[model samples]
Target: MSQTRSADRNETGPDRGVLPQRLAGLGAALMVLMPLAMWLANRSAPLTLGLAAALLLAAAAAAGSSREVAARLRRLLATPPGLALAAFLGWALLSILWSHDKAASLRAWGELALPIVFALALAASGRFRPRPTWLRALAFAILLACLLVMVELASGLSQRAALGLGKLMSFVFNRPAITALVLAAPTIHGLWSLPEGRRFDRILAIALALAVAACALRSESASARLGVAVCALCWGLAALWPRLTLTAAGCAFVVAMAMAPVLGIAARDGLPSLILNRFAVMTGQARIDIWLSFGEVARARPLAGAGFGTSATMHRNPVVAEVAPEHRLLLGAGHPHDMPLQAWAETGAVGAGLLVLAGLLLLARLRRLPAREMAPRLALFAAAFAISVVGHGAWQGWWIAVLGAGILWFGPGAARPQGEDHG
Candidate 1:
């Protein structure tokens, strides 16, 4: 009977460890190549690669331990971050009922949900933790991509002007903002991980961080510069008081929302001339104008909104038309360039609120981690925040892929052995 029971136990055990391991290995390979995927293919390619990896991760988890995967999924759904994301996605889907462009809204919803699903897979798959080797590979890939950009800049890859900035791009479709954003997170991670690394790693980290900063400056992407600055501030705050970091971040968020409209108006009223000149002034004014217009759209439909992806169609708001007539055509076709405004304008107050809730929960999670982990996470968060405040279209496929990849690549690596070097 003992032998019979033992045989039964062996028979009923989860999967053969080999299968899950292979799946996981395959997933890791895809994740490591995500940077190159983004550079060589369309924006969707990176996300496609990430989604494939995530699905494989899920498969690996299920194969390794079905019951464990189920339980983890349940636990994730109950968590604040999960709940918030679920709510936001649900609200977005429901908005399609009233959306004028059903097809477009559905596409937007799918795009928004894809990243969430990918993130969920990462968080739930306990065995699929980010390996340091994979992280290093991604960093090297980014460095190579940056080198290509530098070459392009030197050789004049294109005669087509870059948003009036004359900044160069890789011969490929890469942009300064996207490149800088990608580099910012890992560079911050390198600095944060320096104390715990070997002497060689310390030198490498310093060199990488410096190179990333130089790349950002040379790229001359205002958004990337802002992201870098915000990351620096976050790192400083993390070093000072870990507990207070969340409070200050929350405060800053609130202050920014409160001041967005006012600042936009001020910029239109000649404040830019007093503070900045030339390109800076023009870009600042453009952001301000778009932000104010989005505010108008949100105010027009405080409850249900005009509907997801309907920002383009709903730009006839009298306030936006009057306040920024020159922007009317652009407003009819472009995003507001601000995440909160994008949510509020397209998905209504409920969607925006859920987004805020997700952010707060993320901050809460960060608060529980050590300084070394906290610093890099905070840096990445800062970069995402800054970029969102002045970004491309809300539902831009490539932009979504970039943001998702950044989070996936940098987020899970925060975990370390108990005695590892910390910030």
Candidate 2:
């Protein structure tokens, strides 16, 4: 009945043509299938292929949209999030002039362009909004994937080695960073299901949430654990005081910032050494060492970065060698694992600030939504943010694809309430 009503809602309009609608559906379907993509092919292969299909389909839909194509483009670019995205993308492209390796920088631009185009296509697919069922679907998909991860992990300790049989992998079964990136989707979706689902559905959602959280904790990602902790705190605050939602968020952010230093010190001092030691072998510290190295390199060319994708070349510099020669030699030259540092290193302070501004605009957009709608989006954002804070190359293809998927899945259209079916 709910499904029928949703169909009716779309059909009542001037048909929008079957092709465009199907294309939109196809794009959404691909996004929902991302985890499974990771499981089948390489971690990013499915995502890249799926999203590529999605992008092509969405563009076709947009071109076929009854609304004028130019008008849609203007509308998308006019929004705050859109403008911020444009600023960052434009800045990144312009940096090619100053980029140490123009070819690599141009390649980086191509990778960056994928998400930007995907986002625009999604924006243009106006009626293709995220719904409660879509949320349920995404959550269920992630839940199943987490179960698979657990199964892989259960094979045995030797198999559980980082490169072993059942080691902690990202959604793509790649290397581990933080558990939050993969689990955030399901966890947040599960949380959103609690209030609106039937008894069995609620039970299933709760079980999935608990299971995913446990899996994250058991994994080798400190970031995942930290991100989950933040999500839980936010979930608790919202659950306990539904009326003061924004207040709860403000409190959470302020507290998180204040506690970060303290937590860092504690972690370094062996507060959770037994647990921390498990991840030490994963080059968790080595990644941090790389980030520190990036910081030194970023300092030299603070205004315009060494160039997009230039970190590999700059890592051999004396500045980084002087700071942590042993760790530097051990880790080799790689992109900075942290986004802010990556932006600063490649695009400079201006790029970093624009990236942050875009994020803030996205959050502000979420803030405008009704609480029921906002909750999961906020949770997903928190999870993604926490995971990215300490891991992944800023422009890594898979990372960009995953982040882009999240952005479109929970973005503006997704956040809008669609009457009682959604509420």
Candidate 3:
């Protein structure tokens, strides 16, 4: 049940017209080459964003009839997930009025909004087609990327030097490693679910999973390791009881938003000085101080927040200056480096509550799906959720784009003709 049952019964299918064929080819290329693209990103969000844009446009071209697009969008927006996401986005827009940097808030809101339109359309559109070979190519791509990343890490990043990508640190491969972790879930599930006699595909899936686990354990990125652990756990849990896992994850989001500030304050006060210092060193930031500062800010303005998109410039705002000197280490820190904490800080109770509802609705929409579909998606949610809470900014464009790219396979084309693989 952990496997996603590929519609292998009919590997053969009716012919696709020329335009559809072209779209399938492009989609296949994007799916197969995604891992390499992430590696090439070298931790640059802009490069990742470009890759995500290409995917959205390709999907649009595939399912882009005006009538079809309108129908799909209308249907999606009618669902709880779509409606909740819309409400959250609206709340974000409203926060702009109170934002210290209104222009920046508007820009950030776009980064969050644009990707959803493309993704939701694809998910709701029946015209989009997926290929079996694309899934095969995906596993191979992840395998190839893992081998290459290992080579880079082992050789002191010699390949990076030859590419003229600059003298970036080894942490550059961190994102690629994390990408493989997220991609591995569906890739392995699809491969392992091959028909009864297909031993080769199952073997490949097992090998890919091990390679992904190896990369996560080998990397210096703690977040990547956390993602891998959560992926495995959720993959198993969702297979057995998907509804329970989804409900728990949704409830966790709400509880986390409510208690984030309190936990930060408690940790700062109760944790031993030595333990706090170790945490600071391990995270490579003054994490405790940042947490306390942002925690205090959230506590001070628990309702509407200091306003969206202000986390980056919060140090300059008068509200942050009024906090105690010890909590003032947020200067030029860029972001609080924690997603839920940032949401709690910038959007306050209103934004956080909307986000919690959106998260639950999005996940609940997956209910009653066949076990094959539910497992992979829930596993992916686990990895993404882990990445969100463990690290990264709340509104980073590339992060939003990567999330969009990951869901390309989720829409209504499951029984699509497999002939696209041959076309």
Candidate 4:
């Protein structure tokens, strides 16, 4: 009777810990809803919603109903990488706080804070299980967000003339590359998590692919499109290439594709000309010029950087000066389009080094995990994160931190034999 009851619980129960499970669902749901809500609220809702959700999760976590859940959280906190990542971010935040530009530093700090806290919360919740149902819920939320954006665009309800929803348009309006990076991680996760046998899963995956394509077409953001392609390629290679050589080759192909613009190669005939003509006026070679300028500045200030958010202060070109009168406002003109460049420009070599080191450590840790167990999901996550870094700028720190937290949460402690949970 006890064995039968255990089987039933494994198949269907409250996921062993109610608070943690609910919080996971809530986190996923919020990720989808917040974008649409931000659009409707004209970008103000996200801050409010984020703060409220954080508070609510904190409250729930403090209730202390489940000793098992609490114990798991304690164990996660004791992990070396988890503790180190948190400490490094905390130190970075402190440095920002002590900087001269308190407001800009505060804003940057806030961006990092949200993801870090969410990651910790998710990790602490002790419901680190990556079940099919949870993945479907997350995917459905993203699809719904995409649909809402399409509706807003089609109905002429958006304030901007862009093809995406009004809320995301705000971010995409300023930094489409970053937005693409943020969206890519979750989309890849959803795609990889989908069950192969389910017709609905296949349909959903196809729909998501089409949605990403349409968003890219409508926005005319090359970086966004590249991000999606890179993510897809990464997932494909990781899922199919159980061997190291094939995976390496696949990775090389993805790297080449991502760097095509820098290599002076066009994705399609006439594409380069079209992009140059469309975005040249706004971004000046669609950020190639800005990236070069940032490199020079970083070379000048190799230690502490020009200081966080100091790119505009160092942008001496007459055209950029006229376009961006203030330093912080320079992001509006076209800040560094590359993540490493942005980090180097703002925080200097030290900051950039720390960031790179963190990434390397993450990759190494993920690689050490049991391939048969977490290889597929870990590969998907790594690929998505890598694409974001290579394709965009500093806008992905939050998502990167979140992905790290999720991996840590569901990693060693949550590992179960492949078919153990199968009923």
C-alpha lDDT values of all predictions: 0.62, 0.59, 0.69, 0.48
Candidate with best TM-score: 3
Estimate the Cα RMSD of every predicted model relative to the unseen true structure.
6.7, 5.5, 5.2, 7.1
> What would the C-alpha RMSD of candidate 4 be, to one decimal place?
7.1
In angstroms, give how far residue 114 of model 4 lies from its true place.
3.4
Q: How many residue pairs clash (N, CA or C atoms closer than 3 angstroms) in each of the candidate models, in the order given? A: 1, 1, 0, 1
Ranking by lDDT: 3, 1, 2, 4
- lDDT tens digits, residue span 146-171, model 1: 55555556666643353343333442
lDDT of 2 by residue, 216-244 (tens): 76565566677677666665655455447
The best candidate by lDDT is 3
| Candidate 4 Cα deviation (angstroms), residue 308 | 3.1
Ten residues in a row with the worst lDDT in model 2? Answer: 257-266
* Candidate 4 local lDDT, 1-423, one digit each (tens): 699557544532244356644564565455444434433443333353354346435434544434544554565555554565555465556556435566766676566566655555544544344455545554455455555545555655454556443443323422322233344344444455555646777676677667655655555355555555655565566555544623463454445323422321222232566666765343435455454455555555567655554443344332233232332234444456565566665666566556555544444454454554345444444545444444444544434453443343243333233433211
Worst 10 residues of 3 by lDDT: 414-423
Q: In terms of TM-score, how similar is model 3 to the real structure? A: 0.85
Using alpha carbons, what is the TM-score of model 2?
Answer: 0.75
Q: List the residue pairs that clash in candidate 1.
A: 196-421
